[model samples]
Target: MTSNGSIATTLAPTRETLSSSQLLSSSISSLNSSSTRQASSQISKIYRQASTLFLTRRLPESLSTILPVITSPAADDTNPDASPEPAPISRASRTTRIKVWSLYLTILNAIVELDPDEGKQAFGSKEWKGLVNKVRDGDVWEEVVKNGYGGVEGDVDSDVVINLATLLLAHARTQKVNQTRLESYLAASTNPSLDVSSRLSTPTATRPHSRSLSPVKGSGTDTPRDLNARVKILELYTLHVLLRNNEWDYAREFISISSVLDEERREAFLQALQSLQEEQMESERREKEERRYQEEQLKRDVEEARRRRIESEEREKREEEARNRRSEKGSEIDYGVEDSPPRPGSSKSRSSVKGGSVKGGRSLPSSSPTARSSVPAKNVKVPPSLLTRAGNVVMNVRKLVESMAGSFKTRPMLLMQMLGFIVGILVLLSRRDVKERVKSILGKGWGKVRQTAGMGVKVSYI
Candidate 1:
């Protein structure tokens, strides 16, 4: 029974070991609830922070510096004898002329508070009026000073876009350096190129694991700015793109004015840099040296191989052509010594002259030179050397040997002829393989011999 219980438990999955579908469903519910709660808290916090900061009219951080009161205000404007009572002013509010600077500081802080990602956490939700009120308070200060003073030129209006943008910038940087990153966030959030509403509604581009904006090395990483300088525009723009999209890793690298990507990208930049330079004549010299070496080596190799192949091919072709020429010349050695017959008319003339002549004593008249020369048909002398050669050739054919020897006691002359024929054949059979094919074709049993077939040549003609 205990063993059965163990088996049952093993077969049934534990709650912790849920299938993928169950886990996904559960995780989804948990995430939705958590995000809703966080969102609610964040909205409330930002609103409270905005309210508090905007309401507090403060001087710019730079001019918080105080100077000793050198003179009192006129006690009286109407009477020549009395100076107006000196205006009551705190040390912090003593900036009689640079009041615009103070308004700018109030606006900057209010933007900082609206941004939840920044280190400052607000206590209430989504207070856009807080930013407006801040602007209004600034205006009121300018009014008190009796001049409509300008703070940062564009800071007069309560721009919803800029407010949210500044907040976005702060949020973006909160994950990194609050002060530095906040500006980056503002840039992205405020960019007309990127629609903040769309981004908030839909899934955004994933921020990389690292969101630092450091410069790369001499390898053309992002350039460093004094922060006070006006030329870091492109770098700042790229930084904004990186942070706003939340590509933390790439952003972090761009801002770091020191990171040298010791990788292929750096190599490419180095190559590009090198291309613009022309003083490296030494490089051209080195390349020319290498080319000359290759050319010389190639020339030598070409000469060596050419020396052998060219001569060898010429020799082989010459030999092969010589053999063909010789075979053709052999065919020219014809059988007939006096090739053409005497003219028909000449033969008739000779016949007539012979008949007319005294019997066996004189010819009737000397016929045409050619007719008279057409003498009695003489026997064509089949030279014994020629017969011997034919015999030698036939003997080389393996089957012809027995034929050359003839029946042992039956034909002695035939045997003599065959031996001579075989000897003559040795002179003609140049290549060795010709000897074997000849042997195979000739060396066959008498019963299977080609004689029974009339197509076989019986008479030997040299």
Candidate 2:
């Protein structure tokens, strides 16, 4: 009975394996059907089932089931058919492609964990680069750079693409495969140009291929959520690299971008940002202090120059005074005036002569007692010199005219009066009758004045 039971159990397992293979084959066939909606649903269902299988630790079965769905049949090159044939299938839709890549990458990661040698082989395979390129499509990256996030096709999920990119970057960094290319991919994902709204909402005429993607009935809430998720995932991925490399400043730059992660991570990012800003402010303040120090140094130099100039002027003045004193002493010796002592009575006469000489001599003016004593004679009043009095009269006339002119400058009436007086004077000078009449009046007044004065003088005598 025990032998029969063991044979029966082994046979039952063979049948179950056969049935599972059949089911997998059926699912693949459905996925490749002409009906696109049906194919998309089947692909989604296959991904879910494959993911469950992987979570349950059935790596082998999960890989086998998803691998067939992910791969398409290779073109028959040896069996050439000359007959008419339908066009070859285009690349899979974005949703279908993302699922297939996710499953493949998941299995690849498992292989890496379970078998390091196999993982190394798989990472080095040509398909590795190809898969990375598909996720980070050249055209999509270019569009993002040109037109921001809005330029990306609606079908492509930015979240999935970025996650795949993160995995590839990790692999490349570990293996030291062309760091320049991998870094560029990271730069492209977080490019500052990607700020446009996901819903471009442009007029239809501008978007010729927009009609190709059918609208989802209830995906309105989900669209924005997905976009936010994409942005958050990219932020976290970038921060992981920067933080791991100890680039605090760079990691701090993504504080706002880190909102997609949990609150705890966001707070960490915010703290880093605050620290960076504080550091920047400190640097700026230090620069300002340096500038202030330079300004103070310049002011000190100017003050030093001014002080030196003043000191130089004072020294020169002292030297000039000393020279003048020496010249005076030399002149007294040259004249030999001190050799003869003045007679007490003759002192005044001698001083008078010396003072007179000093007044006439080519010598600098002095504030000595002798000079002060001689000032009374110089101050004695004398008749005004003719030339001096005439010059004083002319200066007074000029001052009076200037005052009149100034007063008339603003007064039209005063100017007119002055002009009339000048015209009257010209008339009197030109006309003989007017001139003779003015002279006769003056002569008569003078004669009368003389006769009155003579009569008054005679009366006083009587």
- Candidate 1 local distance difference test against the native: 0.42
How do all models score by TM-score?
0.18, 0.32
Root-mean-square deviation of candidate 1? 32.4
Best by TM-score: 2
lDDT of 2 by residue, 331-441 (tens): 988677444333444654445555643545654334344443453333558889999999999999999998888888878799888789999899777899988888899
Worst 10 residues of 1 by lDDT: 204-213
lDDT of 1 by residue, 33-117 (tens): 4654553454344334433444563312211221112113444657877423321221111122223223334454555454443
Model 2 per-residue lDDT at 395: 100
Q: List clashing residue pairs in candidate 2.
A: none
